[model samples]
Target: MIGIRSVVFDVGETLLDDTREWMAWADWLGVPSHTMSALVGAVVAQGRDNADALRLIRPGLDVAAERRAREAAGRGEQISEADLYPDVRPALAELRRRGLWVGIAGNQTARAAELLRALALPVDAVATSGEWSVAKPAPEFFARLIEWAPGAPEEIVYVGDHPANDIHPAKVAGLRAVLLRRGPLGYLAAEDPAATAAADWRVDSLADLPGLLSPR
Candidate 1:
């Protein structure tokens, strides 16, 4: 991982575990947690968007509208330091200690951004798809990322749990990729050679990153 100057992490399933979010959705939909988990797994297996799980439960549902309504009803998106993975704090702090510019960016909402900033993690930047109006796996997203990044694409490493969203697209956009094998997609990628192969490095936790980025 030599030549790396910046490390940008994906939010969901990367720095954040997301278990609480899913459970909240299940409660909102009045469905069992196991049902929600099953639907999420089904969509992942079918390679459909995570939103598809909700669509399956309530066809023709306007997810965004529902989110706004949920918020108005006193229950909406919530991100807390408790949602963060155990490795997130120390990992990002260590990256900064190593003089690498650390950031957390991915397909997340404005509220998520605000909540994440509240955590005050040791990172140089924090942004999301909602803040940028461009989602990942899209060239525009990575283009914006490269524009915001402090170094060349090759010098910035984008880490996430999903191969399609993080590894392949980042690599196609000229940034190095790191796959963190923790979430659903990460377990799925474990069975796909191309997924693992696309990442410059595969790690079980963010703790592995500082050492990888260390000068060799």
Candidate 2:
């Protein structure tokens, strides 16, 4: 196997827990927290987009428009160091210490990119789909990611929780993929024979990554 020279991460549910992000949406939508959670779970199981949960609660709702309105109301999104997974800092720091280029790329808003940078994670780069003008599951997005990557596609490992968005696409892009079974979508994906089979490796925690990528 080719030695891994870089490790890139997906944002939601991978590095960040995102519990508060969804709960804040529940507050803005005036929906009960349990109801919001259930809807999100439903969408995840159904392989629906994350915004589908909101559309189920409010049909014809423009997610972006509502986000602007929410910000105007002083109920905007916020992410911080506290939102990070317990293993995030240590994992990224370890990877970098091992002389691996570390980066974070995911389908998120510009504000999310700013918040992530503010967290001061030991990453070489941080980018979002919103900033890239493309998103996962699209060939163009991976093209852009590869453009931003430090090494050849074969030497970069893309780590993420979602199978469709992270695992399959990165593999298709010629980069190795590591499936992290966490989050609602992640656990659901862990049940899939195909998803596990497609990944270069399947792991439950980011902490396992350093050892897995370490040279034998």
Query: Where in model 2 is the C-alpha error above 4 Å?
Result: none
lDDT of 1: 0.90
Clashes of each: 0, 0
In candidate 1, the residue pairs with backbone N, CA or C atoms under 3 Å apart (3 or more residues apart, or in different chains) clash, namely: none
Which residue pairs of candidate 2 clash?
Answer: none
lDDT of 1 by residue, 1-216 (tens): 378878899999998888898898899999999999999999988888998999989999898898898899999988887888999999999989888988889998888899999989999999999999999989999999998978899998999988888899999999999999988998898788999889999999899999899521
Residue-level error in angstroms, candidate 2, position 26: 0.7
lDDT of 2: 0.91
Candidate that would win on lDDT:
2
Worst 10 residues of 1 by lDDT: 207-216
TM-score against truth, every candidate: 0.97, 0.97
